[model samples]
Target: MDILDQLGAVREGKLSRRKFTKGLLAAGVAMTTVPLPARRAMASEGEQATYFTWGGYDIPELFGPYQEQNGTLPNFAIFGGSEEALTKMRGGFVVDVSHPCNQSMPRWVQTGLFQPIDTARVANWGDVIPELVDLPGNGAEAGKVWMAPFDWGQTSITYRTDLVELEGEESWDILWDPRYAGRLGSLASGGDAWWCGAIKAGIDFANIDTPEAFDKIAAVMREQRPLMRLYTDDTTTLEQALSAGEMVASMTWNSSAVLLQAEGIPVKFARPKEGALTWVCGVMIHKDAPNLDRAYDVIDSLLSVETGHFMINDWGYGHSNSKAFDQFEEETLAGLGLSKNPVEILNAGHFQQPQTQEWETQMNELFEQIKAGF
Candidate 1:
């Protein structure tokens, strides 16, 4: 069966969990695999900006204004994780605009691969939520914005509510609970899992660079290693596993829960007592963009309320534009666990911060060793 049919069968309970997972593997869905939506070719006839971004963002719904103006979508390339995207750019894969979260902006800036954005050129700059725009390292001292903050979301525990039981308040400790060992999963990206691990270990995110804090977080992750049935950056695979009953719980973004619920899966995105891991991600212009004007157009279109509507309504993420929240009712926003007040949501969780390159290198290497059972 094709992917959509397989998804339908899993959602309708027509396919067993094990069979569903096997089907996905047979269909070539695995770790670090970008979704099929991102594999399409760039428009050959137009002078378009090359956009490097995550899978779902490549869809035309997010760039309607640009398409309406140019009559074609931007040239799209995708990465499963931020570190991989950065590595490619560092190795000279030039793209007009690339997406990276707040945590990685410092390193991206350090690489000298991106130039500051001229906010005047972006039509929606004035409408963007300030908290997202003013993130550390996002703007230079002279007030040149480095990234155009467009999307915000959370990384939290997404569990099969029908299968997982809670003792008290929900917490990250559930991932380490012996009862669920061998049925748990996590994202393979250290950018996410490591920060989540720090929260679970009771280490302050700001102090994660300290040796004492590092040791504590390392211990928690090492304990979690054997318990995980799989570690992948593929959100589709993670959602499929949860839907199939192959995984009772996994560390995932808000989009996973949204997607599963739409498919009739009994999943819940936990607002852990320790707080969820929240983030803001946006687009930055390449230092040597071939299509600079089109690149600005792409950023402006993405930050528009039309794209914001698609982001919140379709993908369950918060848009950086204040006008976007105006489109939703209070009850609807609350149900989706979002608010027009970005500060409330941002303060409700452990917001990721930019880490030093040395610390990031050490953390990723250690996490990989642990995952490999070394």
Candidate 2:
């Protein structure tokens, strides 16, 4: 069915909302179009906690445990990117929980809008991956932390294997190749693109805070800007563009490539020679959580093995629960670009380092200017 038809089905209650949203995403709808007010699960809306997150994450499969216990999934508010989500929460749009990745963790904490997660409250706390949970600046006290690690993965190029005529081995330079101008796409958010720029500029991530690194990355980004046909935070737009041969390549998370591949599209999530930008992202509770207990339940549910399995097999992300890997063999994991040893994959890439809020602002502003053709 067409997107309009699927949307109509959702409105008529003839289709599940999750299916409608999933169809929209696969059909290339921009994520920014998701309404700002939270979309509550049809049943038990009043008692549900609100989960603010990225577009693909609000589906019901991830909330299995919470639904079994509470009889409904938490209300969901979608954002195109983490920085946008943080901006909304900063404007006093309180949610029970909001998702952010490692690169922005410290800055989120600095905002003083969130409370640390009490490990004791989470049922899956023990099985959660240590390396994922031990992100820098996320520590709260003896046994708590700011974020409960959930999905972890890379931000890298996903290109059409059949269409992108490679001049050499996969690398970050492919995005800047003049031959592909007006046929390439990229994520607009600095959270992904600017870091990839840091790689393309050959700046060491440890010293990424330096003024020199900033200038170099900015220069590299500006040079690549004109080559991009589209700059979007929505995977749908990128996926549709690639699937239809409208775009030959794009910067994307693992899911886009995986989803396209499932449809028998020949694509590769590039293992850029420099390194893919990698990080761990999870859930953070609000300081004034209206449904405090349910918020913890939401975090625990995401950390569960059930959710972990879905995240890995379906989303092409690494889940925090260790046992989630047991169901799949080394070969299956390898096929998906994942491993039981997440730290191995994480360390193999350019793992994101926490930066001060000021640095994030400056970097994003610089990126916006470049995207604006400045």
lDDT of each: 0.85, 0.86
Task: List, residue by residue over 1-374, the lDDT tens digit for candidate 2.
Answer: 87666656555445555455456556556435754234434655447899999886776779889988887778888898888898998898989999999888898998899998889888899898898887788889787899999999899999999988887779998899999999999998899999999999999999999999999999999999889999988777788788878899999999888878876778999998899999899999999998999998899889999999988887788999999999999999988889999988998899999888789889999999999999
* Clashing residue pair totals per candidate (backbone < 3 A): 0, 0
Clashing pairs in 2: none
Against the hidden reference, what TM-scores do the models get? 0.89, 0.92
Summarize candidate 1's per-residue lDDT along 127-146 as a digit string, tens digits.
99999888987767567888
Report the Cα lDDT for candidate 1: 0.85
Please give the TM-score that candidate 1 achieves against the real structure. 0.89
- Look at candidate 1 and tell me the lDDT of residue 262: 70
